[model samples]
Target chain A: MTASSSLDGVLAPVLTPFGPDLSVDEARFIRLARTLMDQGLGLAPFGTTSEGNSLSVDEKIGLMDALAAAGLDMARMMPGTGCCALSDSVRLSAHAVTLGCGGVLMLPPFYYKNPSEDGLFAAFAETIERVGDARLRVFLYHFPQQSQVPITLSLIERLLKAYPGIVAGAKDSSGDFANMEAMCTHFPGFKVFAGTERLILSVMRAGGAGCISANANIHGAAMLDLVRRWQEPDAAKHQTALEGFRSVMEGLPLIAALKAVTARRTGEPEWRRVRPPLVQFPVEREEELMERLKGIGVLG
Target chain B: MTASSSLDGVLAPVLTPFGPDLSVDEARFIRLARTLMDQGLGLAPFGTTSEGNSLSVDEKIGLMDALAAAGLDMARMMPGTGCCALSDSVRLSAHAVTLGCGGVLMLPPFYYKNPSEDGLFAAFAETIERVGDARLRVFLYHFPQQSQVPITLSLIERLLKAYPGIVAGAKDSSGDFANMEAMCTHFPGFKVFAGTERLILSVMRAGGAGCISANANIHGAAMLDLVRRWQEPDAAKHQTALEGFRSVMEGLPLIAALKAVTARRTGEPEWRRVRPPLVQFPVEREEELMERLKGIGVLG
Candidate 1:
């Protein structure tokens, strides 16, 4: 149950930037990863916030080199490698492992809904077996709201029993804090993560790893600050302040809103552009969003 | 708007054949497709039944050439080309178009669930625009049960109005006959389809073009026979026979059941192998399945 892992920290699923042609802006991606690392945050690139599902396998692979070139250690980066296809997952994970990534956050094959646990287990097992690199580590992504293929506790238990070390942990984004708490308690050594910073204090108290949040793209330093000092008495107050962002994000298109704020912060309009099936945050709301962020001291 | 399309008939979302190693067996796939076509079925080679999501984009692209090489006219095929990534979807659709395929059946981006109509519309519009092919025709695949993103009427109307000749039709796999009937009634000359043969008679009666069914893999001739003769007096009797397959498929793992029967019929055990996330049909259930099929006269 040693917490001697590079992955056990506050990580941001880096928001992807796209050029005018809606292509992956590798330079921007690397720059963001570097900036987050400089702020003492680990990086979980290519998770939902990055619109990982919106990028092709080649595009995802193409952006990895820039991270290395930017002097960002692969050891602190956990790129999301899950695709609907087993072969695609294997290739992406194998590539990540080769580059010394801390771990690959994996989503179940989400296209098929309500698959049996045995079927899901087989999917995870096959990917792990095919990747074949002993260096490979996996975090089962449990965002039931987005990915209807839920990674239930029994499924986790099965994976843990089968491949103890390789099945490292999970990211619970069901917005169900109880599930996150249960995961942290049940899997003693596993690195469980909350999808938002609001649960960081509670998750940490439960012996969980840390937060891998969408908001961390904009508030990396703040989240990392709390992560490092959550044992203090004022941790709840810190969490409450952080919880303000979620209220701002509520009822708005979340990923789009995050991108909008990133665009404002970085002075790069391209940060606001999302891939198709994800419209940009409305221009009309930007003023209100910024005002609210400033109200909570989330923006200066 | 003339019903002269090769795609306007019974098309099997052709069952994929996997080898012992679990890689797509191109030769077996071509052989099965050829057999189905020979039995008077059009081909939708990469739909849900085909384990389309279980395949990588390259793997899907690699299989297309074999369909062309088998003396199978691509104009008689409408391959499923949707992916979670817009680029991947565009690439797949464009590839299908270039090969002279009649149409591409497209699932909306299935990864991010509950995307807005605007976002979904933008995804479709973007894929169509980026593909930039005039000859391309698309069948908006509405399989909400698996994809979780339902293609509502308003979304369909938007797509249709925007792309007159291009947004040719839809395949309603909701198993809700009312929706299919409504599509047929609401949009004149739009080709609506049922996802199974049991609904074929009803769909065609309501002006649906035909069916793109999974059972067509095992029972192509029987369904196609019913499709051709549904206008005849004894059509109900023919449909009753076809409906028997659904009863057997009920409460069983569908794709696996289809594959097991295909294996038995072809005398190729390899047909039973599915990619990971979908285990082979339970060996124990094979006998009962076979017995039931026999009872229904689905087996010789």
Candidate 2:
């Protein structure tokens, strides 16, 4: 499966499950992935929702191995393999390609701020060259709000010029429609995934690819339906509903709120645990979130 | 030696030298460390000046081992060991303690933004517990401008109460004197180091520990002199000179400019190479910076 064909739908940035000891609950994680796949959603593991940066390299690899061991289609998975260190990025990206992952969501080296376009290009170039995998497809993750390192159009252009086949796509998590529209219009064939579900309908209508969103963990079917019928007469209605649910999710700590919804749905309280530098969703906030989610008919 | 005495006075946040291929110039690094020590300065490796976050874990360990092998006094060195991952921080901190280093300068787990105080405290707690060393002394690196995660006084109070010996002090790189002053007065006996040499005289006069400044890479003696004469009547004169040099350095990209100065002074152009996500200083900008420095009687 090529990168474009395999990853052209609503992909869920899956929430990682952790045990009481804060160790990754791999069994539960695999179960969650299988559940999402059964619902016809693609898997995007080790993303912002997955607390990918918090996990050690060994832990990330171990989780990926577990998913493969469970017999999931690797082509349906686009794991986030970016790291601050070039070697770490190279290691994870190579492993994903070897595992037959359709693509990898790559973030720029985020530690330093205000990097030059040449430097950003060099980082991506070095990683791709070092990975040395012909099958590697990189979807640049441009979430400047969090990473503080924006993947500018010029850098994208340079990467595309240098490695057309490997630099396949991008996810614009900047939450700016103009930027996403610019990406879609500027690169005719480049796959562009909306980072939020609220923008799914508009993105699909604007000749872009689907979204890779955190809310897809619970609302994948609704988002996928929007993607499938974006041209229909009542598409705006679905878009509005998604916007409502997304607003509720965004009103709280996104990762924790998503975990709360997953815990409630799956009857597994263990899903509520987040690694340090990320605390659990506060109990009162979770209660309020559940109320709002239920009011929007998302949770019962 | 205790963390307090060994890390006192002027400390240089050393500059890292990269070869033509951008691989770490380990021999040059060791030579610079030795030279700094000869000038009565302590070594703080793996700092923002050292591009600590850019280096891979193995590379960092290799450099630390090289420093020890060269018979430098580890007790006077406080390497920056914090990372976005808890395991990385634990490994680096533990290694520093085992190497008999005086202390480790740790940035809070910085990937997640808007984290709660509890979460930040938990991250430090987990790392300290995991390192499990009696000699581990952590000087919190509070550089909100870069990390976007500030280490507040309340958090410091909590950590000091919990781990009195381990939570040693902080380097206020926020460039906000008011915040640094709060740190000094709010917690008596806590070692506080100014991040910039421009603040060195005021920091010392306020009964804080000296400074760990990037300008120390080129002007260690000037800073040490100010530290020694802080209580004297002529202290302000030294401070004015240091401030003049610092203002010149601050006028450009700090890391690249420092590298440029080092290159010109040592007649080794290799000193100007910075890793990706940081390009080399532009020729025209370098010339401008050199002119400004010479006008200030710095690089003659």
Candidate 3:
């Protein structure tokens, strides 16, 4: 399940489970992974929604090991391996590749502002060169809205021409359809996954691989179905439903709302405890979100 | 020395020295500290100009320990100890207090966006609570122009009221003289250090302690002279030279230019190496910067 091979399906940025004491609840995390796998979705843990940046390298590696022990197929997963430091990103990305994970979603070392494209090329090339593993396939994560650094089409061209095999594809979370269209048009065989569910149909229409969305944690099956039937007779109906769910998530601090929905569904109260600076939703926001979820038929 | 006992002075955000391999150059770094001390300047390392967020905790702690080992007076220096992670901030800041450093210049946990005032309060208060040291005197760092997170006036008041002694002053890098004046007026006794040299006179006029500027590396004596004669009839003459130097550094990457100057001055050409993603200035830019410096009489 290397990225050079195909990942022609939906993938969820899985919800991280915290136990009562707020430690990584590995078993529950594994359980969630299994649930997504059972629903025919691929896994992407340790992404932005997975609180990837907050976890130390050791914690991230431990979680991956636990997932492997749980017998989840690594080839179907694309763990996020990005950090402010190049070496940290390299360690996580290279290790994930060695573990037989499908591909690494690498975010640019993002602390600096307006890093030149040449700087970006150097960072990416150095990581690939240092990892020095032919088995590794790197998928650039282009969430410029958060990273403050974007993966431009020109950069993609430069990387592709330099090392065609090492740089496989990208995730365009810029929420710009035109940018996604450009990637899909220019890099024909490269796998382009939408960063959100809202763009699934457009991405698919433009010949993208399926979406790797955060909301997949709650509406996994529906979004998966939306991707599946987007070319079907009743495509519009499912697309509208998917868009509605995306709207709710967009309206709030998305990660918190996703955790809230997960908590409500699983009755896992500890799921609601986010790290400080990202507080749990206050009672009113939580209640409103719960009602929205129930109204959308996501929760009964 | 506790911040409350003696916190008013001009502190230089000391430049970090990098070896040819871009690893921490301890000897040069310590030498820079000694040089600043000899010239009647207090020391602060690991500010934005020092590329603190770009450093590993080990690098930060190692540098601080080296400074202490060199028998430099910690009472005259405030090493930056803030970071995106609360735990990391605590470890570095607490250790600074334990080592008897003057005070910790603490930046807000900045990776997240628009953190609530309560969250900011918790992040600050919790660090103090965890360190739980009576000797800790925190100098809040407000550099919104860089950190993308501003410390508002109300928040400052709240933190001051909560921990009267633990929170001492602030370093305002907003580059807004009006804001500095407001801060000085609001917090009567709080020592405010202008983040930029351009604002030094206005800041001093508004009762600011002094500046913690990156340009101070090149114009340390002239800037210090301005600080000294802030009330003298000929003070403006020295400040004009400082301004001319500042304009050149502003036109280039100040940190890189400063390093290049140090490298050439100390005969450590290898110190010109910057970490990846921040390559050394192109030869033309370097040449131009050198010419600019020579014209201003800082270089020959």
Candidate 4:
């Protein structure tokens, strides 16, 4: 099957757990990923919500190795393999493709802001040429808020013109539903992933693929169910519940709040430990956040 | 002597030369760096102008090794060692220290935009701790226009309070002379390096250390001269000339223009090659730019 066809549902831009020493807690990571997969969601490990940019190349490579060793089906995984360094991106993308990953989510070379379209195109072309893999499927990450580098439609057109099958699709984390809808409309077979599940129903109805979400780390089962039954008569109610839960989560720092919710579910405080440049969710607000989650029926 | 003491005067964020294959040409890089040193400037290799962020850690380490093997004095080279990944930053910083480099210029962990001050502190603190070397000196790089992650005065104060000796100084590249002046004014012993030669006189008068400049790639001897003769009667005229030169350079992509100028000066056309995400200077504009440079008395 084509990469786009295989990537047609909810996927967790998975939460990466760390030990007290801030090293990737491989066992915990594996367990959490397995649980998400069991909930019938795919994995986008090392995306922004996963604190992917905060991870060293060597650390990420080791984590991928661990995931493979655990016999997790690599075909269900589409890791975020982009970096500011072209060499690093090429290395990670090639490695991911080698491991039978469904695809790789690639951020633009983000360190330079407002780069020329020629430069941006050159960066992608350079990496693709260097990787030289026909099997590779790249999903462009357009998160202008975080990366400060907007992946414009013209650039997508240029990329698709250059590499038809290899260009694959996009993940729009910019929160511009119109842009997502435009991608779904513009590229007939393009896989368009909304960055969150809050827009999954509309996104799916737009002939978009599905969501690759931050909340999926906490609410994977519900979101996966929504993706499956999105056309059902009760789908509107389901989408509303997801939206309500997301609104409360949005009030807190995203990754931290997602981890806090996971910690609550599993009784494992260490799950709340984020790496440097990302502080832990505040203990002071934990009770209040949990109470609100319960008020919204997001918690049992 | 301390790491700070040895890092006075102008330092070129030296240009990186790429081959036809776009791999770094170590020989050309070393030759260019050696020439800059001979012109009485220190080196800030692997900096923004050098496409440091576009380079992998392995590539940087290899460049460092080549420099050492060529007998370039490590104590005169304060390479840019910071990365979005704390682990990569720590590794590069420690490596620079172990090589006996004078100081390491560091950008804050920049991937996540508007990170909490607490998180910024943790990223810096975590890297400093992991490197675990007292000899490691850090020169904070404040270029908000590029990184979009400002290194605020409050944040600097927190870092200095935590690690006084290790957090040596800063390079203010925000193009805000008032901020540079304020830094030099507030921090009694702190070394504040202006990001460009245009601010050198004012900054030096305000007790800033000399500049760490991209223009220094093409105009090292001139900037170094300005730093030495700022107290001379004719210094104001000298400063105006430098500013005029800078104005023209700013009109183009700074690094690409710098490289184009270098290519002209050295008669080595390959000097115009820039890595991806940074295209070469437009060939069509070369004559006009050169004529403008000549008009300003910056070119022969």
Candidate 5:
């Protein structure tokens, strides 16, 4: 179950679960993986939704090992292995390959702001070179808005040319349709995944692989349907559903809110506990979010 | 000793030395710390120069503990503990306080770009609340240039007003003297440290807590002399020497070049291994840097 085939369908940045004490709830993570997969999602855990940045390197590896041991097919998994430090990134990405993950989604070394496009190329190239695993599939994770480090088009071209097999595609979380369009057109055969659900159909139209969205945790079936109906005559309905979900998450802490909903749904109230500095949804915010989720009629 | 007095003085953002295998060279770190302190420097380790961001949470804590155990006085130490994660930041800041560190220089939650000022306030406020350590002297580390998240004047005011005792001061690494001046004037009691040595004279005139500089690693004595004799009629000579040393570092990767110089002076060539993504000084750059250091006549 190695991820040898193209990642050409719906994949969700799976939500991470925590116990009431905010420890990684391994049982819940496995259950979430199984549930999302059953709901037709290819998995990308330890992503933004998973608070990938929040987890320590050891914790990330532990979660991945847990998933693999639970027999989740690696081909369907693309865990985020990016970190500010290259050593951590390499270790995570290499371990993912060893576990047969279809690909490791690598974010640019993000701590250094406005790093030259050349620096980014060198970082990626060196990591791929150092990993020295021909089986390694490198998918660039572009979330410039959050990272404050843009992965320019030129760097992507340089990487693809240098390591054709290793640099497979990108997860474009830039939130700019023009950038998404540019990525799709500029790089032939490089699979581009939309960062958000709002642009799923548009991204699909622009030749994107699929969306790796945070909202897909709760709206997995609908998101999958949205991708499926991209070419359908009634495709506008899918787009509207995505917009509704987007509206709920806008101007709020999307990750925090998403975890709250998932916790309630999965009968694990403790899963609602977010790590510090990212407080749990206040009572009013939680109620409003729950009401909105019910209105979307996906609570079932 | 607790830092009851102003943390004024020429504080060097000391560089960390790693063995060829990239493990922490505790001997080099201690030697460097002792040499700088002997030359009248206040110590600020695990900062941008020390590749603090590259270190894991445990590594940072260990470095702090090692320095303390090496007889580095807490009142003279200002460790860089800023990170993207809140819990990590809290742990670092809290531990520093417990160890009686002068203050923890904190970078904001940097992964998320352009976070609202309110969000920034929440982050700082939450950290102080969670640490709950009165011994803590929090210094807002405003390195907008690197963090990509600027701490605005309004946010600073809000933080100061809300947590008067917790928000002690700030280190403005923005390099804009006017901003530094504004901070000094606006927050009269606030200890403001200029990030670079270039503004030492101006910042000093503006009631600023002397410079917290990267170049101070090699220029400590010269910078201290200038600070000590700012009122001396012959202080211009000291200022010129300081500026010359600054220009040398400005020509190279400031952190790496400082480590190289420190290693050379201390006869520890192995002290120059920066962590991954930040490669070592090329031989040519090293030679060029050495020539500048020699030309400045600051080194034998």
Candidate 6:
């Protein structure tokens, strides 16, 4: 099936909340996701900001089940399902499709470095074949910095040629506008989402899909404003404001900083909790960050 | 409990053979492990050479169970049990320990880059505590090139301090002898295995544990000879020969090249099958590699 038209627009790679015991705080997480949806943003959970790799498959499946049971519209969701193991990618992507989710963000098997393009194509091919679902619509997750595995254009072309409908689009988290432009330019119909909101205007003006960004967790309304006003004379002003807020989040470990901000805003201290290999933002840094946000009028 | 004395010597990061349908060939795997044991070398399955990350958790556990059922001595096995997910690593490691395996080669949670030492320490601490098995003995697997996560000397020190008996040693795959040297020098009683057989002599001479090399899958006898002769006067000569053979394997993708060599030796065409994101060595390159091996008197 073709990608859902609703898949486009300002989407937040939703931040995951954890309890004091470090288990995924499902209620807090759903509340945050619902808040984003209420603000007119699409939901892209389990992206880099969500500590997707740090979580187990069972945890992810359970979270999806929770979201579905909460009566959240699955059509607005595009969960990140890529993993180092093919089996994991299959398991996650199949679950999303079965849930009638809009699409799945598939990362190329990231464990092996410098794999042949043919090898990567084979991986995507295998996943699609194994899932064997007509409803499967894949938006390739291309975050080279984090995964160290680039989704090159040639590989994309090959996948598109082989599976025209299933290989729907990509999220260019390379943070390279030039690469995003290339994807938009080279393939006319392929959806290309800017990973960062900083280039939202440029991407939209260049005939590309909207952004799926980390900062959208806190700044979804501002980003949605930019998406709606890209053709307006004051668009650049909106872009500047979005970038300003994004820079604040980028100043620290992005995920931890986001959690810290959410904890302060919601008055839920458990929002500050992070799983291991990802320590919570230091207390002093959290205070400084809050002061800066307040100074910038992001916080009162 | 402390690490078993059986944890020493030339250990093969045993290669995994896949069936034509891309399924793990469990019987073939057990046969290879038995052959390595017969040749007086230890077994370290699911390592880089074994495509450990490519295999799913279920596949790895099944293979381990098959080996255990075949009456292979678990005391001589140290399977690589690291994954990007903490729960997956814990699961695999706990299974290995439950099977009475001697030790586990653990890779740090690798998906996140530039994590704080405290963060890494916390990851290891949680895994060790969660597994909570007195029989668990962890040998940290440090391969910066692959995992992009280095097991720093300081982190090692912290883990050792936190879990003395459980944190036994490390496998230094950084290919940086100085780092290996520092690990060997600073940690006197801790076992340190040279990742490559080239450093076997120096590692043994420096009071390190032994060598865990990919080439041992095909050339276990040669490596065992070098291990035994590291203290003899002709030790340097043996090291030189071992390096030469390793160089031949390193001339191409180490895993694919080794598989090609195995396919040629055993006349099992299925031995050439590799999972996605890792292609087979090209037929032309395979012929050339065989010619080179024969030239070096390594092939008949």
Model 6 spans > 4 angstroms off: none
Model 3 whole-model lDDT (C-alpha atoms):
0.80
lDDT of 4 by residue, B168-253 (tens): 89999988999998888777778899998889999989998899999898777888898999899999888998988888888689
lDDT of 5 by residue, A1-300 (tens): 122554667788887777654568898889989998888789998887788887777778899999999998888888998888666777889999999998988888888665656567767876787688998988889887787778888888888889887788888888898888898899877888888889988988988778888888888788788787899988988798779878878888777788788777877777677654466666567777788778877684
Candidate 3 vs candidate 4: the DockQ winner is 4
* TM of each candidate vs. truth: 0.98, 0.95, 0.92, 0.98, 0.85, 0.97
Q: Write the per-residue lDDT of candidate 3 for residues A1-300, one digit (tens) a residue.
A: 135554567888887776654457788889889999999899889887887765556668889988888888898889988666665677788889888898888888776677778878888887788788988888899997677789999999998988787788888889999999999999878889998888888898998888898888988898888778889988877788888877777768877778887877888877886654566767567888888777878766
TM-score of 6: 0.97
- What is the DockQ for all candidates, taken in turn? 0.84, 0.74, 0.44, 0.87, 0.36, 0.78
Between candidates 2 and 4, the one scoring higher on TM-score is: 4
Q: Which candidate ranks first by DockQ, i.e. highest? A: 4
DockQ of 2: 0.74
lDDT of 6 by residue, B1-300 (tens): 277768798889999998866889999888889988999998999998999988888889999999999999998999988877777888999999999999999988888888899999998888888789999999999999999988899999988888998999999998888898898888777899999988888888888888898888888888889888788999898889877877787758889889989989888888898888999888788888888788776865
How would you encode candidate 1's per-residue C-alpha lDDT over A1-300 as one tens digit per residue? 333389877899999999998989998888888888888899998899889999999998888767876778889989999999988998999999888898999999888788888889999999999998777889999998888879999999999988878888898888898998888788889999888887888888988888999888888788888888899999888888888866877778889998998888888888999998999999889989999988888867
- Residue A75's lDDT within candidate 4 is 83
Tens-place lDDT per residue, model 5, B29-129, is 88888888888788888788778887777777888888889887878888988777666787888899899887888888777666667668888887788
Tell me how much of the true interface, by contacts, candidate 4 captures.
0.84
Clashing pairs in model 5? none
What does DockQ come to for candidate 6? Answer: 0.78
Candidate 1 per-residue lDDT, tens place, B75-96, comes to 8899999889999999999999
lDDT of 3 by residue, B1-300 (tens): 124635455677887767644568899889888987787778879887777766667788899999999999898888898776555677898999988998899998776768788878877887788788998889999988677778999999998898887888889988888989998999877878888888778788888888888776656666677877899887777777778778777767667777787776778776576655666666566666777788979866
For candidate 6, what's the TM-score of chain A, rounded to 2 decimals?
A: 0.97
Please identify which of the two predictions, 2 or 5, would achieve the higher TM-score against the true structure: 2
Off by over 4 Å in 4: A1-4, B1-3
